[model samples]
Target chain A: MAPLEPWEKVLISADFTQSIHGRAGCVACHRGQQSPDKDTAHVGLIPDPSQDAQRVCGVCHGEIVDGFGTSLHASLQGYRTIVYSRSVPENHPALDTAMQNHCLSCHTTCGDCHISQPKPVGGGLLNGHNVEKTPSMTRVCTACHGSRVGAEYLGKHEGIPGDVHFREGRMNCMACHAGTDLHAAEGDAAKHRYWGDQQPACKDCHAQVGRADDPIPQHTIHGNKLACQVCHAVEYTSCDGCHVAISEKTGNPFFKTEATYLSFVIGHNPWPSRERPYEYVVLRHAPVAPTTFEYYGENLLPNFGLLPTWTYATPHNIQRQTPQNRSCNTCHGNAALFLTADKVKSEELEANRRVIVENIPAAIPIP
Target chain B: MRRVGMLLLILGVGVFLGACASQGISTPTPVPTAPLPEAVLTPLSQTDYCVQCHTDKEALIETAKPEEKAPSESEGVG
Candidate 1:
């Protein structure tokens, strides 16, 4: 995305001036002087007042602001869960510093969604200071999630079509992910996005699935045995061996991935629960290795094998009919489509032992 | 010739009056009202200097500087 012009960043519109938020006056949110002089007016200016959402937005939106502290978007607890599992308490300080430099920038505030683009994308006002109830899918939501989720949903990969929901239904992220889910309540203790009940499950809308008298024979036989993505999802991105370091020359943090390619691999469910109760689910290779945070200190992730490198995945690229579901033989007896012992790296084989399919299902017998 | 000149002058006056009527230009009418106490006039009710300047397109363009690149890094696994 091209960066916005200087004027475009600060320009205010007439519609905003008459809005309920705008009527509160600039100083009500942004604590700045009302003087005509530019320097005098900018004294003690708060560029993003919503950074302190408790005091600023809480006046009107107290309910949301109260629970926002625990939200994944604000707390970034999911990252900590994985990072802590891989490191000892002694190495926390160094790991924290690395995260602060490289990962903390992804943290979002209220203004990041409603008023401006995300900080990662060089935030500018989405619509001349007007507050958007539903953030722009292209500008705000996809700005950070663009690398994999955005690409898969929008079909950026060559020869791959976009998700059927996006291509056919024109449903944006908000269509499935509700605002309440994004602003997860204070007591909600789910560590990872996939840990709890599916926020937007397939069965929520498609109630007809798994019915006894269903028309499709596969629906009855395979519904409980496989995750919907195992058959519905097509090839999606899987990254490997991502390393992060601070540049000595420029003193800026950056990350490099060893490889990123499209693949479709079904493996045993690593985190099977009531919500995701299936023997088989799609897997994607995450961009993490033993030395992922080595820049901070030596062997920061000593227990890296505590978690699998090829984690369970729910790819965004869904299709009504995929190559895997064309017929029983398309996936059955097809060892190439399954993550087996030979498919994994030598070092990671131990970590991913739980997910690797030991016995690929045999081909169906002929009549 | 004198009669023709008289008719032209009358037509000009009629056209001028019609244009003014079309534009809804009428004499101002005064309505009486009591002045409110000074305490009722709050700062929130008025458009402050900040809004006055920011809404002005010309003023913003004149003051805005070239955008500086925001420091960024590659995508991390989430």
Candidate 2:
């Protein structure tokens, strides 16, 4: 910042010559350099920071620009959201914003919704202005999510004895992760299947034998013997502590799978594990066929955040207004309870009844 | 009596069609929340801070042995 030496001034002017607008000094953008008293908010995810920076990128990286713009989500900023809509007067109901959350989340960039940056904190929301892309965004993702998901959802399991992707396919996570919408709903809301949907009972998936109308209870038979993590998980290396679990550059998990399968399984769902009525089933495997019990152990692992609070506000979980646990019967009502399977008739599981999960739990069979 | 019923019917339809719900919009009603969610700022613990990227090694998976699947021997899986 001090006056450059004569040779240094030559270099600084040479650096300035590289710019399209050579008249304005670098101080135009780096105003903080002008005076220690001023520091600009280094925020990213802003609207059209000097059109040249935001809109003119197509001149350089045409394809990346087009892809990001066509992605639809690229246009999310400077938009009205649900909160603004709700504030509308009752007399003027057709406000600009739609109440649906699907479109609204994009309006608030990923960093805004989660209240942090994507990778290594995306330079913090207020400080992300002049950043280029980095491998860290995915790390930011796993920062919020955890490694077990990579293993459980994508089939990248470390505990599978030999790592499958490592052995032959050399699969990298980007192979499966170049997507954003992870909702099982597949954009169809009729099933209301969201990654975050709360289901009173997973009986829909875990019970050995349940019709759509039956309560998904903990499997009372041998089905419970297997740990849920054994089947329902895939990649956890990135989640082990870093992101980009299996780097495409180097097709290996950042944290190699260390435990044997039996060890991993036992560590998670201990055989003869406590059979108490579990209200929370955070991670479980997808139910196996024929019997189709949506038992609690379907894809369980990770050893943390299994408490009621973590599962709260999840779409499948009935959302309580507050984070505090509502009474067990708030949604269950007297006729049916939250743990449909636990509350199921002993005869129901023995017989393997049919179940239907609506806002309420009721057995089928028009009896 | 029939004429009176007809008069009431016409009045009812007028109110239904001409009147709007507070706002001119006619929409389905929203359900009630048992209790409203209050917002509180929670501080992140260091381990939780670390969990932002890495899978928390301490995640708990719940599995149980059904009476049916109980092994004859209780030996742990090696």
Candidate 3:
């Protein structure tokens, strides 16, 4: 997406000044002097007042602010869960420094979504400070989640069609992930995104799936054995070996990943709990290594091998029919499509053992 | 010593009378009025200074700097 011009970013429309939010006046939230002089007026101005949501937005939106403390977007508990898993308490200082330098910039605020494009994408008002109840799919959500989820959902990847929900149904992220889910009060205890029940699950809308009387024989046959994405999702990007550091020359934080390639591999369920009880699920290679935080300090992630580099995934490039489910023989006995012993890197073998399939299903005999 | 004592007594009487006369002649305290009720100012009650300059497209264009491409790192790590 093209960045908004400086003039375009701050231009408030005449119509907006008459709206409910606009009527509150800029100084009511922004808290700057009402002087005519630019320098004098901006003496104590807050560029993005919603950063302190409770104090600014809370005057009217108290209920939302009350629950926002636990929201995944605000707490960033998922990132902390993954990073903390690979480090000991003693090394947390260095790991935290690395996160501050490299990760926390993606930390979002209320205004980041409702008012403007995210800061990660060079913030500008979406429409002259007019607050949008539903954020723009192209500008707000995808602006940050662009690399994988956004790419797959929007079909930005070369030759790959966009998700069926997007291409056919025209469903936005909010269509499935409602405001309640995003601002969930239950999010405080969540270790990761997949911590609880499969939210916005395929079964939620497609309730006929996996039922005994279901028309699709494959759904019944594969009941509780395979994840929906395992058969429905097409190829998605998998990354490897991401290292982070503060650039000595520029004094800016930077990261480099070894490679990113398209792959569709099914692996044993890493976490088969009550919510996600599938025996098999799609997996993606995460961009992490023991030396990822070396720039912060040596051996920062001494327990890196404790967590697998290849983690459970639900690719957004879903289709009604995919190559994996083309026929019985396509996925069965297909070693290439399975995360077998040979598929994992030699160094990652130990970490990924639980998720690696030990035996491939035999191919059905041709009648 | 008696004369000095008499003079000191006169000075003390004069100082006391002067203080009394000053207080009597001073302006009488005005009657206190009820404190004004807190006004219930509505939203957008005040003139928004931020909107004033920001809405001026010509001024913004004049001050606009050349756009610089965002760094790759800002694109984010997986």
The per-model lDDT (C-alpha) reads 0.88, 0.28, 0.86
| Candidate 2 residue-wise lDDT, A173-286, digit = tens | 434334332211222211222212222223333354333443533223224443232223221221111111223453322222222221110111111214312222222211
RMSD of 1: 12.0
First chain TM-score, candidate 3? 0.98
Winning model by DockQ: 1
Ranking under lDDT, best-scoring first? Answer: 1, 3, 2
The residue ranges of model 3 lying beyond 4 angstroms of the native Cα positions read A185-189, B1-47, B65-78
RMSD of each: 12.0, 29.8, 15.5
Is 1 or 3 the stronger prediction by lDDT? 1
Candidate 2 CAPRI assessment class: incorrect
Error of 1 at A236 (Å): 0.7
Where does candidate 2 chain A have its weakest 10-residue lDDT segment? A262-271
lDDT by residue (tens digit), candidate 3, B49-75? 667678888877886666776455523
- lDDT tens per residue, model 2, B1-78: 999999999999888876655557557699776986899855332222111111211221111112222222212111
> What ordering of candidates by TM-score runs from best to worst?
1, 3, 2
Candidate 1: stretches off by over 4 Å: A185-189, B1-47, B70-78
